[model samples]
Target: MPRSFDEILDQAAVPDTVTDADLDALKQEIVRDVTATLMFGARPAPEGRYPTTLDRAEAALTALCAELIHSTDAAEHLARIADLPIDADGALHFGCLLNLAQEPDGALWWWQFAAGAGNATAAYCLYLYHLFHGELRDADHWAHEALSLDTDIHLTSPAPCRRRKLDSPPEVLREAIERLKVDEVAGAQFHHPDHRLADQIEELADAC
Candidate 1:
C-alpha cells in the first residue's frame, strides 16, 4: 500500500480496473513502447535525422505494385511499404525494423530502394550492413554513396534493437508508420495541389 498521499496520487488512486499488478505492467509497457518508438519510429541515426502515421493501407497498396529484388521471407513486409512518399525515408526506417526481425535480406532491399531515391542515411545503413556481413567491397561503395549524399540531410533515422523487444516493436511501429504515411499524404495534398498523390502512386505502380 502507498504510505503517502502523494504516492497514491501519483499512482492514480488504483481504480477497480487498475489491479495491483497493473502498475508494474504499465511500467513495463511504457518501456516497451518507448523502445519501439526509438527502434522503429523516427529518431536519429548516428549521423543525425529525426521522424509519422495513417495512409498505411494506401502505402501498402503502393508497395504491392512494386517488386522485391531481394529479401528471403519479407516480401510481405516489403509489399507493405515502398517508395515511401518522403523520398523513401519510410523505407530507411522500415529497413531497420526488418533488421530487428532478423530479415537482413529485407533490410537490404529497402535500403537499396531508399538509396536509389538518394537517401544518404540509407546509404550509410547499406555501408554498415555490408561491413557487418564482411562484404567490404559493397561496404566501400556504400560509404562513398553516403559521403556523396551528405548534403541531403533527412529528417528520419534508424536505431539498433534487441531480440526480447521485438514482440511489441512491430505492432506498435506499424501504427506509427501508418500515421506517418497519412501525414505525408496530407502534406503532399496541401503543398502540391496539382500533383494528386494517388495518381502519382498509380504512375509509380505502372513504372514498376
Candidate 2:
C-alpha cells in the first residue's frame, strides 16, 4: 500500500539523534545549499533517484496531494490550491516547491510573503537561505525573529499530522546557530567579526 503522506514523512523525519554531520550530509544530498532540506515537502525522497530531489518537485507534490485532497493527483491539487486564498502554509510550501524546481527567486518571494504574515518557519527558511549565501548578519536577524515567534511550527504540507511532526523551530535553529555563535570565541570564521553586527542588522531589518 502507498503510505499516506504523514506515514511517509514519519519515516523520513530527522530523529533527535541526528547529528550535525548527519544534517550536513543530508543537506548536501537533498538539495543545494541555497535552500533547507528540513523545510516542508523536502523529505521522503523516492526510492532510487540518484540526487534524491524530486524532479520539479513532482513526487513531493504527489505525496502532499494524497493528504491534501485525499487523492494523489498533482495537477488536480495544484489547480485547487491555486484557486483558494493562500495562507502561511500555502506560501511556505509554494516557495519550497519553487526552490525545488530551481526557481529560487520565486521561492524567496513567496517565503517573504509568508514571513511577513508572522510565519516562524518562513523566517527560519530565510535564515537558512541567508546563511547558505554567507549573509550571516541577515541570518542572525531571521534566527532571532523566528525564536520570538510561535514555537510550535509545522511544514506547509501533508496537513501537519502528529505522525509527522517537525522538530520545534527553536530546537533546530538553536542547534544551527550554536556552532556559528561567535560570542564565546574571539574569532569565528563564518560569523561576522563585529559583535555589534546583530544590532545593526536589527535596525536594518526594521526599515525593510
CA lDDT, every model vs. true structure: 0.46, 0.47
Q: How does model 2 fare in lDDT?
A: 0.47
Looking at candidate 2, what is the lDDT of residue 42?
46
Whole-model lDDT, model 1: 0.46
Estimate candidate 2's RMSD in Å: 21.2
Candidate 1, residues 1-208: lDDT per residue as tens digits? 5379887686886567777699998897566445534443632222233211112211221232122212232333333344333446556655655454344555577678789888887786776666444344686688789889886543222322211222333443333333332223322211111122222332322322
Q: Model 2 over residues 85-113: C-alpha lDDT tens digits?
A: 25665565545444433344655676776
Please give the TM-score that candidate 2 achieves against the real structure.
Answer: 0.37
Question: Highest TM-score, which number?
Answer: 2
| Model 1: per-residue Cα lDDT at residue 189 | 17
